[model samples]
Target: ARVAGFGPDTVLLMVLPLAHNYNLGSPGMLGAIAAGGHMVIAPRGDASTVFSLVENERVTCIPAAVPLVVNWLNDPALDRFDTRSLTLVQNGGARLSPELRDRLRKRLGCQYQEVYGTAEGLLNLTRLNDDDEKILTSSGAPICDDDEIKVVDEDGREVADGERGELVTRGPYTIAGYYNAPAINARAFTADGFYRMGDIVVKRGRYVWADGRKGDLINRGGEKINIDEVENLMLKHPALHSVALVAMPDPVYGERACAFGVLRAGATLTFEELSRFLLEQGIAKFKLPERLEIVPEFPVSGAGKILRRTLREIIEAKLAAERSQSAGPRRGP
Candidate 1:
């Protein structure tokens, strides 16, 4: 937690499951203990309990996922609790939109740190002393001085700075190979040993900017739609609490963009309204989701990352059922 500016006086609130590598091995947890800081573990699924812990324990630092932060911001009980004691807020596991970052800073009155890391052990972090512009736009510089990062194309050749490419890294803490998974290890690492992180990123000077997962792109009639880009724009809408964009099967276009959203508590939004909002954001017409699904909650992994593959399966199955119903039984000759 020293890199994040946590100290012996810092009281940290741990809400994420300890089973996840991010929570178990994070500097926020280990460094806090090393510094003799107090750690309070909060119960899952209740935002009120978290707020109460922060207010009662005077929590100074919190490491959480982006979705949890979004839920806390959307909770009506936010204003009912005193959260001024919170000073350091670290978010990882998912991308934090510039809009959400600004809102968290203003509402929580805390310094927001955006961390970029992988389960495989590559870590990049933005410091607490970083300016708002750097914190909002870049995911921060590498944590270790000797850590190396490279953005490469399909041929494994490094790309120019500021150009988007798959991010690869090699560092002291990074894992060399997965246990008992030789097949995966072959494709997941380079000949020289850099791990392929499967994320597309752009390097601008000292900072790296994430552009979403390489496989998360949706091709709608040869046009590629960056899922994270659409989700980030959608999250800027006042009614949305969470959003996941996936590609749905479309016979005509081959594939179409579909957005699944969870509205804020007691808030209502229509597909037309959401589409109009995206249009106003200056996104291309083809990039706008042709279909919308309102979900109560998104399926998340143990690490708190949204299960977009599961969501795509749900929508594809529903479309198949609809098509089956539309086609009547064939009569025998």
Candidate 2:
């Protein structure tokens, strides 16, 4: 409620289900009671419906998921509606790609706030007046002054500022246990009690930016590849609407990176063009995607996070089929 800038005159719009525990709705349903505001729940979670509600109700703020934002950006009718009343658009429940964030800023012409949170409890947010670099780069500072956080290496030793490591936290509101799962809880929490977020991140002062999950890495031979880093660069290609980088099995290298891109409306991009763009971005030769798959949309988890595992499976199956075809039909005894 405090971080959302909710007040007596604020008009907050809710597009996701009320059951969703996004930071925008910690309690009191968009903090209407906590801060004294008006909350408008959308009847249908569609772009047109959302735009209409925002325009009619004079919605000042909306806390939404990545997919809703993507649909709004790609919708042709977007310009026809008036969203000038919007003061802020908060995105969470999934990563906000650089390209998507830029588009949202330009299209809505409002403050775009990003947050990192989970159902288990920790929350980080970029303030409405934060500098462009902080808002666009780091995930922002913790919501509470006493929220204890630590970035540590694989050995559980705290890493230096700006060094990539896993983020662990134990705070006033953060849960100490996960109900009845003792076996799972043992590995999920540290010996002393901090909850292991399993998120690879870089911390500087109170600001932290997540790279991806600890297991979300690919090893191309002996070289370690950060999938999110490569995907961020690939997303800059003009023809892509969204990009997902995942691993595909290889006989020699063990695993290789493959890119899956959803094309922008009326925009087509070839693998050669994308590769050239990534190279021009100054990425290393080893980070270039070995294979490209163009799709209409990438699979997403129930929480709206991109399901890279599903994408990896898709690409690996495709490779297997290609290999089988190349070898031709086998003789049957």
Candidate 3:
């Protein structure tokens, strides 16, 4: 309640699934109860229902995903309802793109806050009064002074500020162990107790910036490309609506980056055009995507995060089919 600026009069609109910890526990239910505020649960997360509820309930805050905010901004029915009561829109469950952040504030006339947390530990959050650059660039500082966060290299040694490494944390609210998976817990937590977040982060003083998940790293001939960085760059293009970068199987390079994107309505973007744009942006040649697939939409999880694993599988299957077809049928000896 204190960190998120919740108050006794705050009417929080809960649109995320109740099963997720971000919604059922911290920030959503806990924040409201701690602040002595009211919560209106929506049956569905559709923009129409969410907007109408906000108008009717006079909701002061809402915990939403970035994609939902984008949908709301693009929905033609947005002007039909009154959303003047909304003061705070907190985003979680995924990295909120800088493009989306700017659009949210410009179109909604509300304060945008980004919360970086996991099911195991609720971590950083942007303050209400933070400057635009801090809100748009970094994921804010730790939730509390007591929350211990560290960015460490593979050897478990702390890295310098602005250097990317795995982020680990242990705090008052951080969970100690899994329910019944002892073996998994042994691998998940450090010997000292900090939960290994598996996210690559760069810290500067109090603030931290997420690069991508450690498991999501694309090792194209050991170049080590971060998929999140590529996606963020792709979002800057005016013709692209959404993008997801995944590792595709490469015979020589081991694994190459493949970008799947959704183009803006009635607009078009080709692989050559995107590659040229990345070159113009000063992106390193090694980090450029070797393949690009334009799609109508991305596969999303229940929490509204892009399902990169699913996209990788889709591309892998397509590649396998192509190879099989290329290898013509053999004749009897």
Score each candidate by Cα lDDT: 0.87, 0.83, 0.86
| Inter-residue clash pairs, candidate 3 | none
lDDT of 1 at 204: 76
In terms of lDDT, model 1 sits at 0.87
Number of clashing residue pairs, candidate 3: 0
In terms of lDDT, which candidate is stronger, 1 or 2? 1
Question: Hey, what RMSD does candidate 2 come out at?
Answer: 1.9
Where does model 1 exceed 4 Å of error?
none
Ranking by lDDT: 1, 3, 2
251-320 in candidate 3: lDDT tens per residue? 9999999999888788898899999999888899999998899988888888878888999999999999
Looking at model 2, the pairs that clash are none
* Candidate 2 lDDT score relative to the true structure: 0.83
Give the Å error, residue 32, model 3. 0.8
Which candidate, 1 or 2, would have the higher TM-score against the true structure? Answer: 1
Per-residue lDDT tens digits for candidate 1, residues 1-333, read: 667776789898888887676676566678788888878998874678988999999999888887788888888888888998999788888888888888888988888988888878877889777887888878888888878899999899999998989999999989999999999999999999999999989987657999888878898999989887888899989898889999998999888999999988789999999999999999999899999999999998876789989999999999999998899788899
The clash count for each model shown is 0, 0, 0
Give per-model TM-scores: 0.95, 0.93, 0.94
Candidate 1 collision pairs? none
